[model samples]
Target: MARPKLPISATILVKNAQDTLQECLDSLQEFDEIILLDNGSSDDTLTIAREFNAIYGNLVIHTSEFIGFGALKNLAVSYARNDWILSIDSDEVLESTTLVRLKELFGTLDSKDLDSKTSESSALDSKNPKTPQTPTPPPNTLYALPRKNLYNGEWIKACGWYPDFVTRVFHKDYTRFNDNIVHESIMLPKDARLVRLDSGLKHYAYDNITHLLQKLQTYSSLWAEQNTHKSASPLKAIVRGGWSFVRNYFFKKGFLYGYKGFVISVCNALGVFFKYMKLYEATLPKKPRSCSLIITTYNQKERLALVLDSVRELAVLPTEVLIADDGSTEDTKALVESYARDFPCKLGHIWHEDRGFRLSAIRNAAIREAKGEYIIIIDGDMILHPFFVADHLAFATPKVFLQGSRVIVDSHTSESMLQARSEENAYKRVFTLGGLKARRCKILSHLVYATSRVDSKFFAQKDFIKGIRGCNMSFFKADCEAINGFNESFIGWGREDSEFVARFLFNGGALRRLKFAGIAYHIYHPENTRDMLESNHQIYLETIHTKAKFCRYGLKDL
Candidate 1:
């Protein structure tokens, strides 16, 4: 048997909410009516809404002109017969516990004569049963309830997402929402009172990185438009954006939530960054390209630390830094967490469960979370030169991927190289660690960068993919996406990078060999075994044979 409907009318303003509409409507089953003000939905949202209307027989669908959030909400509330309006977003669902509380409140405020006060005189003299007491009506105009925000279905307690109090239940006759384009709120009268209701609203903030980035882009545009009169510049955006990351990741204890927390913090900072950068573009000169440095690491925190320390001394810093951790233990996470506190830009740790060698997968995961248009990838063991990032950005052009060489250093030399030690001893310690040739072109490095300075001094290796190291690579994010990221089929470390570049070349991408600059110091470590080399080589050969443009399993799979 169905329960009787409450006297409250719930309202929602929806646009392409097909993913969350059904759950949102189902939550309002106890209300007398549900109003859906749909602007222009091209998806099956209307179909879903009509299906619910057929079953419940309490839903009212209204097609209205596209307007601001507040205006559309006010118009929806006007058609309701009840004075009380329960405002909810398409992504928000009512909690069962919260529904019971709403029902109890609805019962209390059900009287039509709201002005009449009930008599409650408990104190009666011994023989004064005939005495009359003053009457006072219950205060019930606006109600604020707590909301819990979820990201990727995880309860994100930090990032200002928990205990989020929103005034949803309100008397339409007393208050209406403000007519702002975005971030609209209910306008309460000077004497209006509020009742705090039990929390039962679950806000599905984001489903994934793509979902988060898309929402941030849209909302930031609206935010920048709303504040067009404010002054903003590139420098201001960087400072504010960095500060936002620090505040959310550290001050708000977002680090306690792990990778999801780090990504959310980064996205939050990106939200502020896009709003200001959008402002700069609308008002000031064009902004520079934002670069993200992604470092891939295993469990080598010592080498990773050296790499990060060298990164801090770069001449041109990247917009942000992300560590693609491949099944590293807690130590790596701790190192990243500690360094993130003082990092010049936002530092995020993207980790995956250790399942042998899945370099391509981890890199793809980190790339998806990057907020920069250009990405520079390096191994965690490679200590960078001060001008490394600047060198990459020098030749960073569309449809081009730059593969740089590294100067391999033995363990003894690596320890002393960055310590202002003897160059003779360092050069003596630089020995070949494996069968491959060590790139120890120290004299050439000095003479080439010193004497004959050629403009864009890099060869365009159009069809060549051999001898290209993945340790130092830079490419536009769009170009990588066009190839659908690295081939995840090559589970082992042998030919993943080569196969990636081969696909890039076959897909009409230009490759360049960065020389004389963008140098990296590779810390000597025993080379990974060739256990899976034969299998990976077969995969690489197939890619070249077919001239594969995209991989079946890559970024989109994540």
Candidate 2:
């Protein structure tokens, strides 16, 4: 049979890798096309890539600033002309035999048949593409090759480094890397299959102890920064470091490599030790935080104006006010601008195109634009009490999210209160609500205190979550980033707030309920159609089932 014409694209990302660039390029000569994404290379890296491009017309070079490894790789994959992607590292050289095997595998397997087997039955019609969707990988096939690492000038095969299986070959439509700054890995569907190649790639990971130590510091810092929500202590770091050394040196049989094994083991322990130490350092006390009040609104200009007016009467004003407008009209913009003329604090309005209910996305945008270290989120319809800001600030605890209840105003009372521009009328309408708890909370707002509660369990109880309204909540920006803000995939209202609170708890954030402090009166409005509620509730249940802290399509993905 004739050799298959496999249209595979070899993708590589580099930064100042002049030394190993040529060898890595030479190893990938069999590939139909090679994509090189340069990350601001200062050395001869670009020169080498240009030379390769001249020699082999298959080379395509693109330059960009250094993003994280996962994001950079995803970008490079997007540029590939072919469906099959062969991801190669700058310091790794592919084996010639592996290339031959890959060609043989592709020759025997029909791509269309594989797609039919792997894809969902209701896969998108390629002929009629509407919205952008993530591509599904072809059935039962991603290629995993063993990687051999080189330490200094020697191949340290026995130091728990040999046969390092890495999945590098995949259909671009089905796989993408996670967006982690360091130690990023590809995420595959739950049922994807893996095929192992006989030949392996050579990884020139480190030149000497100096280079290894340098990388240890860099990777440790990235890991610590990524895990800001995780608590780290000195004793825990010491235990983890010692355990790592023991596990790698003894259990994994690293001692067979002699001095190399010992050095590798020690380095491994040190890396773990430093990672936790840096995490501990991050938890140290810092400067006083500035607060930003994020008010979410959707086309309710008059109600929003009332909320802003309430802000003007605050006992303690926030550093700034961020309006998370969910596709509101120009009139809402004008209203915010009108308030900005003499608002007590700086004012910002973040508005996206109206696309139904995108409350999560707008909130994320507002959070990103907010300059304050702490954020207080509320709805535009919820007119706040005078002491709301002061109360939130007083109870603001590190790594704890504050959830406050709202007093619902009936339609009759809301109309009367809106007609009358007095704060006293708003309070009177709020007190007339049927529930004694609401009346009591509103009457003794200053006397009642907040109660701290940590839900260590994964699942959110309905009664507990019912009180955790997004209309009145506050949290540290760092904690919000840790759980990746909110799941933007949540369309329409419903469980978005509860799901976020569940994730906040899942990521080690304490939950505190403000009984009387941070009180707000929820003005009556016609209920939005609950058509999407069941679907959104199912999504929340799934989140609880998976105990998901960070959503795949969250703030970072934006």
Candidate 3:
């Protein structure tokens, strides 16, 4: 049977969108009517829309006070003459085939089809008694249009960018926009029947870094406003903010986009960092929520004062700061004790015999002396964001054992830092054992060497977590002890932290990833992990997989 034609219109809300208004209006030429709502654009966007009206005759233009995004969209729908509406952004360009298919689908609807598609169509309203009885509608009520977004002058084919679907074409009465300052889209109920379209809308997001940064700053401000009541801790802010960058660039595959991708990832990390930092600065009170900060050092006195400075400046002060010195020959003991004398945070330091860099062992010693119910572990070279501690506790859950995120730092901040010891330092942290996922060094080695250059970069982002660096992570004290505290046998750098987390997960323990929460920055350094490529930890991988056994019993008695 041939389909019947239904009344339909295209409605758009624009404000200062001069450059892209023509593209949107031109695409709506075939519609019964093109309704454009202009919220006071100083540019030629309104003039251009008027030109489209003169030529296309069916275009209707409406103007109003510069209202919020949702209210403006809602006002545009009120002026729409047709019941069925297509809401499009000023930047969007629709394919010709899409318009043809849309008309064809609307014509074939019958009463039985309405019943079948009642679940998919937002227009099918049994809940609203005010809904007017209508003829049988098309088989599907809601149409899902995929989006091909062009970013940074190129279309992102990977990293979950392409063919992203959203239901934009729907009945105006059934859809409404949420009240939001940014990233606002139409909301449809769950029962709406969905139909996938063959073609997609093209979204040219942020043409360059300048646009990107501007948008980032806008969204970050909105985020800070949304989370207004949340207080900040300088230690928590700096530490967690630093890790957010690590996770995105390395673990999440932000580096695959190369320089552009790296910049975006860093921006994302900074978003998390600065949001909390600002929130802490504004909201922190004199009487802070007390917690314990644990730092273990081995010959890191040169950069220790920076860490202490960061700690002292935290918006929310900790009850105690425990520094466990693993026989640092260079004044670590004097440095910590001196600060202990003057600081409000009770300072505790444990000096052990000169042992190899057994970081896990030293951390375990500090945990034993911790006084606060909540415990945070940070590297000695780490700098704190103002709200670092506050964020962890804000989103902390009882079921979650290990909670961590990323921040932005490279070798630029501290030369004496371990991460800056070699050239591959940043690459290894971004590509290798960084994120909160299970990846074998041997498997990555074989693949990196065997695969083509593009393939390696592509697979790395999609398959791995991008930005988890060791210096900026924390977990509850009880949870740390439950996993026997970072695998004692897996001595010296690489895989020890990751391996312990894997063991924790395998034993009914969960890893809570604070992707956009706690962020930290990595100070750039020459990579110091070349030796770990062939370390004993590589051999330990076999034992972990063999019996499903996770932790060694050697430190169980501790």
Candidate 4:
């Protein structure tokens, strides 16, 4: 049999998408041709696309009339020459795997499937001769692509941002966009067989707060205009405006999206509020819901006890305290158990075995067990500054995952730990006579391969606190689960936290270094993790440069 030709072309609808157009085009280079519809660009958008043609194998550009968003898209798609078409916006980029998969789907395109219709069975004709209408699937026609949107520079892994169902690739004859004035939904045939693509669209829709507000204003203005012309009443607009904010921000988990997401929800609310407020200035009223609190934790017995006491003493009690613990052998378990039994408010603890030092694993394990609608994670060793949890909860919304911070203990305390910890180079908790903090850097690295004895000062200065610590961090339960939880392979005391945070932020998880919002005090302890740190450090040195889908059993082998 002859190899099937890849029947795919990509179409992009653009209007001043200059700053982000090249990255978009680069992602779709595999397609046979690119039809760019520029409404009217004062920028180098067209010039850049033309320039890309030199490097990209095949590309075609078409300028469209600035009629409207949907009309412009429709006009652009009308010019595509290929049987199958892929559409993307200027702010999005395709993952490599997604591109390969799309091509594979194209090569196997079945023309006959798109043309087939369902046969009516004679047996059912007696009762209801008039057959019910069943929409046909978009055979070779429609591909439901995943769009991962990033707001305020953070990839929103949750809050309905990532894996958004967008109809990107399609057969030219069947798919067409509707001609709505604002916030228009896509129009497709009833029988469209939508195949979801594994690849994701990295969308930087709003780079910051200013951009987000601007877009909201445009959308709201357009919406009001459309509704005003549709015989909308003042009361209806008011109700819808209030409901929209409540629905998206509180009900849909927008609060979990962090500051950017919270802003988006607020903008969404404003869009609804303003649209109605403009439509019926005197009649409309908007009411916002109060915020909910969430908490996260792991193995610190004394510290956990302190947090529990502080929470009980709070003026405004949290909706709940979510204590997430990795398996703890010391009083940590007892602390959590006691909180669950004696605490006045709703208290819960998620417990897992003391596996290796997989912070992500522990975090994920705990998050799954969270009961609060919104969630926040904190370390056990740190003491919260009363309003710490309240501050994050205050900013809660479905679209936001608040990132909190931790300030180290007083200089004197740190100085004391530094001095006391620098006494031995290879300090192991098991061998160090019940101490929890170890002061041995040479015991773990090849730098001490020759010398069994370790210098405390050198070890403390070199290895004690270089990477990002998980002592203070918070996000939505839904968002964390969406990213498949944190990477579980970084099972060591060093660099793992930084590595996971980098992934979370890069994948569009918004962050806010709570700096002054949540203050925490680090407790003193004899080093308990010397052996595990040494082992994990060696693995980090060996494969630190390697970024794989699954980090090959870093410390699991031992």
Candidate 5:
């Protein structure tokens, strides 16, 4: 007589998985039954499933709206026809060797041994009446297999991607998937004998970088929604992002894959950052308002002209322009007035006497005179991208001040840009001779913007704060007023911005770092005098020591 077929069923949950579903089904031809639970798929996924069922007699297909991975997988398990169920995703393909091993393992299980195990499991379940009794497996049969994930046409052997052991093969009676919306795993009975098969499964996770980013966006949003009840700050997100990169790249030996490894590691960090950022945003109130661009200036009239020209090219213009003049020459005033005629929005200047390094004072004067509900502050020497204003507005949330970053243009590029003085030309040269960091920023701007983490931990780090320049920062007018604005007591340029940020945090305002979106090109110039560095540092220290949210010598004092 012919031997009875091994009682094994392969199950998968799918949604728009046309690309890999065929390969996955083909790989499981040896199984007694194939159970497919598909979420709503507008693509050719259902057609392919039907074709496979026609070709293979044991194929079973079910359609449902996705509830959660855990719940959906359990539903798939319930539809499985055989005693042993091998759970897999639509994107995964089991190896031929793994199939052989699974068959061999299942074939060895004696029916008498299974009956004894089931009796013992029932007795244990009776002893603990509070615990729900699941199906019991045979005496010695539970299986796990390593999964090799593919990304960007490459097998990522490191960065915590390899040897991804999943407990997929289990007796239908003894195990079920945990109820997690994402990253769901199988839950095994305490008494089930677990075994890891030498053969593995191939997981085609992402087709390319774009695919990875799309998933990152979707997954992060879902994670944030799920975690809305949990408390998360921007600082915690930053720390988690940074630590994720380090752990995956160095400790996980992701460096073995070269550039691809680095990219993967960075993407991993970004996932963490975006999740927390969304979570932080959920806590804030939403109120739309107009914005005023506050440009601080001293000298550099030529560069200031280019700055205004760039502002004119903005996709979304500020409601008004406030030039916070710190005792500049008549030439600077003339430049501002000249642009006022052609500038897209209302333009005005807040001029003060030529007192040395009185940026804090001039900014306060401008803030008091400003009419817009929001303020985007940048130095006159810093030229902005067309999307700068729009990006800030897109990410704007109440009770949060945005601290943005800039790409440093070397002195040569600065001169080149000054001579051209065109917004288009300035943006074109942002990648060339603008320095290594600038090129990197230009290439990965979107990723950087998506994952920029601003948390208290990053704020507290001195070296990290250096990247958080006032050259590109935005805040709500009300929030600025609450903190009494920039501390005019800060004599020089050094710690004025840092002190202000510290106070903002102390007042329960969260800081968000804008990486690529609110980018500015900082024109290189001679270093400012740091003679007041010691005094400024002392004042900043005092702010921290006293836990002072409002400075006595701020905008109001001025």
Candidate 6:
């Protein structure tokens, strides 16, 4: 005979969870209903879930974009049929014995006085049989249960894995999860009775080392974003990281679990270390940061004067401004020297010997000389929007490089603007005379400038490196150092920027398109000589194919 179903509904937030959703749902068969809340899953997870529903007829599926882990969990709970909610992850399953224990706690299965009937009975006596039914839980009560975490199908008892207690069973009216980007928790209500259960939940969390590291990277970034503060620094990372290893491996007995335990302890320490390090990187660019705005230019002194005039109009000035001169004449040097007298910030010119187009080498030289933890790189021909520096500062992220939009001034308009008598007149020409052709001019989101900034993934992909503009991109100084800056081997103009970005992606960094913000206007000029494009492109392809994380000659040599 089938037992009466427990008066509980399971709620889960799923995203590409096909591999573990089936077993997770299978363990909740005896519940009254199960709700799967999907957040933009691109896998076969829905198909597998629907198939499970066809047989069990108790699953409720709902979909929504992810807001955050805490809110998403509460949103899933709202769709459930019962107030008695069982919160579970797609990677966890309720153990069989634990399920029975859970049922007994709700008073559904009555424990008979078998101690008196065992001596002479047929076990299933004809007279006084027990009746099984679902029971109601006490009001204002929440349940916390122990969980067993497994890696490679083996239980990990150390490294803070064993007897991990989590509050999963709760009443909808009394408690909900706190809204946090990472490490969210259920809020304990006033005077609420917290019941800790001995029931175990099996979390088939991770075994594949690669996937585990990926999760660690993501979680650490989120944690860093959520914990940003003015005082975040490198010391916190180093101290906490060292403490985690010692505490877990020695004190917590993680070393006794053999190599697996040792790996877990090391990974835990790394997770904490990166969480703090990313925070330090992200927090540095919060104010009028010590940012170096690198303007790459050559012999175009007249055009360079207009660009510098636009720089004078920046809403938020950089800490130091540098002209990365690629073998320009003495006239360009004099022009920059004139501006440095009373420029808005400390302005200087960094020049190397004029060689055949050595944009990559000059950029590397400028990077070495710059003293900012955050760097914004642009070409000298581009006229800046008033909010360009402010927008770039606001859009700064820890491990992600931002590529931004630029508007174009046609050749005739560009000539007229360059001929203006005063810097103010040239600045006025920026908005009045600019036009846009994103693809032809190598730009995107050109006409969408506003006071607000919006990041667009429309062009962001893991392997995407095309349409990148070195003229309007921002990255952390640390990240630039990680990829060893640009590949200086590209002697002439071509895919230098794209090759730099490709190496960044390979170095576990991401690309985010800065749209509706950080605007620049490109003055029309004859295209640079593409004589070395084919060779440069070959270098780019090699970087991608070899998964190269750094260039041998760029920042490394510097």
Q: Report model 1's TM-score to 2 decimal places.
A: 0.46
State the weakest 10-residue window (summed lDDT) of model 1. Answer: 452-461
Write the residue-wise lDDT of candidate 3 on 1-558 in tens digits: 533434677888888888888887777776778788887789998889888889878788899885566677778888888877777889888865565555445563445445444223333223333222344343237666777766766766444455587677777767676765545677767767666665658777667878778877777776666567776777777777778778767776667888866776677677777778777765642222456788767777755666676667667777888887877874888888788888867888877777676776777677777776666777775555556666555544433433454444545335544434334232223222234332223344334323412212222234222333456556556666666666666555666665555555555555555443343444444455546535745644543454223465324654
lDDT of 2 by residue, 254-352 (tens): 898887788898999999999999999887645337999999999998788778878888898999999999999999999999889999899999999
- Against the true structure, what is every candidate's RMSD? 20.5, 17.9, 20.0, 24.4, 14.5, 20.2
lDDT of each: 0.79, 0.81, 0.63, 0.57, 0.79, 0.81
Clashing pairs in 1: none
Tell me the spans in candidate 3 whose CA falls farther than 4 Å from its real position. 1-6, 108-140, 227-252, 274-558
Off by over 4 Å in 6: 110-134, 286-558
How many clashing pairs per prediction, in order? 0, 1, 79, 37, 5, 0
Q: Distance from true position, residue 439, model 6, in Å?
A: 46
On a 0 to 100 scale, what is the lDDT of residue 245 in model 2? Answer: 93
Over 1-558, each residue of candidate 1 has an lDDT whose tens digit, in order, gives 456577788999989999999999999876889999999988989999999989888899898976777788899999888877889999999976566555555553334323332222122223323222212213345667778889999989897777688988888877899987678899878887665554559999899999999999998988787778999999999999999999989988789999999999999999999999998878752223899999999999877877888787789999999999999999999999999999988999999999999999999999999999899999998877778898888767666777778887766666665453223233223333322333434465445434422121122323334667889999899889999998889877698998887777767776667766787878878899889998998988777667787899999863
Displacement of the residue 502 alpha carbon in candidate 1, Å: 66
Off by over 4 Å in 2: 1-6, 108-140, 288-558
* Over 4 Å off, model 4: 1-6, 108-140, 228-235, 277-558
Score candidate 4 by lDDT. Answer: 0.57
Instruction: TM-score each candidate.
Output: 0.46, 0.49, 0.43, 0.43, 0.47, 0.52
Candidate 1, residue 452: how far the Cα is off, in Å: 46
lDDT of 5 by residue, 1-558 (tens): 333444778888889999999999999875778898989888999899899888767789898887877889999999987777889889999976565445445553334335434322222212222222223446345667778899876889899998787888877777778887777888766776666655669999888878889999988987887777888889999999999999999999989999888888999999999999999988665755799999999888888887887888888999999999999999999988988988889999889999789888888899999998889899998888778898888777777878887887888887877777754555455545335444325436556544665545544654225555788898899999999999988877798998888888878887767765676888899989899999988998888777679988777863
